[model samples]
Target: MLNNQKIKKMHKLALYESGEGKKHLAISNYYRSDYIGLALIKNFFLTTIAYGLLLLIYFGYRSEYLMENIHKMNLALMALQIIGLYIIMVVGYSILTYIYCSVKYAKAQKGIQEYYKGLTQMKKAYDREERRNGRITGRRTKA
Candidate 1:
């Protein structure tokens, strides 16, 4: 959404000042609001899917040989070999996805904070201008 900043800027510029314009402004306002950022969501969901798939693949393959032989100790070592590589891969990717999620989460939070700060400043500016224009201007700032 932040990546669409230029489009947002242009949209703000093409103000028709209708009720539709107000709704559009509200939508963009929330888009840039301090609620959620796209990157954090993207990474978290992607990592979740990847990790889920990895687990499913691991357990599915493991089940093939072990379901019937679960209580059998004779083929334990053989099962371990087949399952060990999957474990290693899952662990590695799990760690990687964790690191990625952490970074993306922080980045998204920073973006939200910055966006809210910017929105606050904008509301202040708008209120000041409205006051100058002799219009009621105390709603957002009072919040």
Candidate 2:
């Protein structure tokens, strides 16, 4: 009565459901572009906050020197430089986030495909069993 193949598949499904399968399933629910875009947005905000904090710390550390040279400093150039650096940081992080998210989405998709394959096999095993026991006497109907 034991279906070894079905049992093995059930165990695999259970293992996946209890592990990274949950995350993969969740990720699979989103379109690739949407997932990547969301990650990019999150990275942008985090990068902006981190850059702001870095600027604040730098300013605080050089507060005395900055105050002494406040009048001599080219304020416009300093502002431009800071803005340029922030832009670069944001762009670099966004690119990395995009790539990472794309890979993650692809991996999730692959995992889901394997899970579905196992499910299909399980269904076939059940159908085979039912047919063997004469439980399914009528023509099969796809639901």
Candidate 3:
């Protein structure tokens, strides 16, 4: 039996292939949101690691300076700065990724709409030809 996620994927593929504009758009938007959410989570992990390394390097290089000001340095302030920097990096990366994905999805949707339009025209022409012939012309299954 197919799971819910698999079923949804299949439905999306059907909508895409059948060129159902409204349904496809709705489903695609859901998919895009899910993608963005996952990307944000992944970006958070990456940004944290990167910023952590940078902080380590900065502290290492400034060891003497930090030592000199150790008496005056407020631990709370330092902790807050690190936390704020991490939040900033994660948000910035997530925004950039969201924008990029949105543009790419929009372009793809346009192309899919065009494909649907062309398919519609073709079907209309086929129906018109069938009517002109006074009978359907296609393979028939044996009863």
Best by lDDT: 2
Clashes of each: 0, 0, 0
lDDT per residue (tens digit) for residues 43-128 in model 3: 87888889889999999999999999999989999999989988888889889878876776676677667656766665665566
How does candidate 3 score on lDDT?
A: 0.72
lDDT for residue 68 in candidate 2, whole number 0-100: 97
Worst lDDT window (10 residues) for model 2? Answer: 134-143
- List, residue by residue over 55-105, the lDDT tens digit for candidate 1: 688779888776876776567676687468656655665566556645555
TM-score of 1: 0.45
Question: Worst ten-residue run, lDDT, model 3?
Answer: 134-143
Better of 1 and 2 by TM-score: 2
**Residue clash pairs of candidate 2:** none
Q: Report the lDDT of model 2 for residue 138.
A: 67
RMSD (Cα, Å) of model 2: 2.5
